[model samples]
Target: MSLIHALVAQGSTIMAEHQAGKRDFSQATQTILSKIPPNNSKLTYVWEQYLFHYISEGGFTYLVMADDSAGRRMPFTFLGELQRKFIASPTASSSTTSLAPHALQSTFGPVISQLMYTYNTSPPTDDLARAQSELAQVKDIMVQNVEQILSRGERIELLVDKTDTMASQATAFRRGARTVRRQMWWKNKRVLALGIIVALVIVWIIMAQFCGAALRCGSN
Candidate 1:
């Protein structure tokens, strides 16, 4: 099975176990965490790992840590990391062929709505203004598309055409966001490179002038 399918399956099992008051949540959490890259610096993993340990040990310190840090930071980072990993990994296009439109709509619809609402109500900060604006626009467009489909209230075949449409939109959003980040990175690199080159040139000119003065003095 694909990684996504495996994750979905594990998630469903974990939910079931949690509802039944079983002790499998820790195992399931560990399994999921193992799949993520070790280099991931997101604090969500620390939070989840702490929660898992807390549940297993029933220790007060684990609970305290969870309450103090994990509870506040994990949910958003966890969801964001899942989204990023899902987009970055390769998937069987055929598997996505079976996904229902309403399923897609139901899954992402509320998320997009929440983002839209958040962007509109939140004041722009100096660092996040561009990101906020871009996210707002993307959410607006996604909301319109999802609403249009939901309005039709009819089942559409998970055809290539529909899949392509959704995939293209997702790809475009990811590409555009990454493009902005890459441009900023390259801009900084260019500035640093130019500064280094200029400094080297100045040093060479100063050394040449010094050598010329030394030669003239020695001859005189």
Candidate 2:
């Protein structure tokens, strides 16, 4: 079995989540609520490789979905660690209401990320027999989704270049717009005024002639 997703949520609202596998589990997260246990429990479908394990406390729930081979106890162990962190940290604990994803991430993301790093790197020391040994087997078969995971210095440089190019283009666009507005004002001011005056004069003369013709017709 291969691990898939780590999630923190309350009721239907998601707090934070991380994915490890290549498969798109977005639908799973969206639909998994119907099957969510009211308390601490594991949801396992016989046909599905991924299992959902969740624990509810203080109106918050920590959930983790992993390969069925990941075993029930291991995910809970990870979830337990998450629970402790969530309680101890000011991030979610500080919020009196439903935790916002951004706030949760800003405060709890680093810890959750570190937890993922540790679990991915090595099994928890507490459950060596049940967790680490089995996890190692899954790790051997699981291929890293480098696209979603890896960020070297080169990627950061590329991002900086892209941001710079976009900024330059934006500056150039503003400059061009200002130049066009200024040129339109300076170049066309006198010509525009003259054209408007000429058009008005012509209209006035036409109207006067029409009135004169009407008066002549009536008098004759």
Candidate 3:
């Protein structure tokens, strides 16, 4: 199966298991949260903030059940909301650009492309919205940083290399988008052909009845 198909199938199985109560929601949520890297302290903090806002806005209660020695659940909705607001605000837009100059230049290309892919799949109106918004913000920051580095007239070769990498990523994204569009077109064509076949059958029946009526009139 294709990667997309495999992902869909896995998602279906997970949903089914959850609905059946074989998988607990909290456990699943924690599993997802655990997969995020904690080493990138700044990014980790931003991500946690975004998650808090999303859950709060949806009026969902989330508890870090394992963290508290007293086994107490704390309301985290407000913190999440604040994080969401901060991320969405224009002031927080340039935060990612403030990384070490070398780090920014070295990782910006791949990171931007990955962020693009993430944005493409994100919903504009949900918790994913914050991610999508952040990706745009990050892209802008990267662009500005690249401009600044190029202005200093140093590391010209590195800039060229990064530009080439970005070009390849854009090409790949376009190819994937085109393939999806073609598949959708083919599906629509099949549906249209079925409708045309049904219409032709109806027309054939009508024509046959009309011919019979004319023959009867002529014979009379």
TM-score of each: 0.25, 0.51, 0.24
Question: Model 1, residue 218: what's the lDDT?
Answer: 100
In TM-score terms, candidate 1 sits at 0.25
lDDT of 3 by residue, 101-179 (tens): 2232232323323332332344134644454455455422111111121333321212123446799999999999999
Quick one: best lDDT, which candidate?
A: 2
Using alpha carbons, what is the TM-score of model 2? 0.51
- Candidate 2, residues 117-180, lDDT tens digits: the string is 6776786676655555655554222221112212431221111233467999999999999999
lDDT per residue (tens digit) for residues 1-220 in model 1: 0011112111112211111122223433434333323232222223212322111111101111222232322323223333443344343122243343233333433443343234234523442544445444542211011111122323221212345679999999999999999999999999999999999999999999999999999999
lDDT of 1 at 174: 100
Pairs of residues clashing in candidate 2: none
TM-score of candidate 3 on Cα atoms, chains taken together: 0.24
Native-to-model Cα distance after best TM-score fit, residue 11 in candidate 3, in Å: 50
Most accurate candidate by TM-score? 2
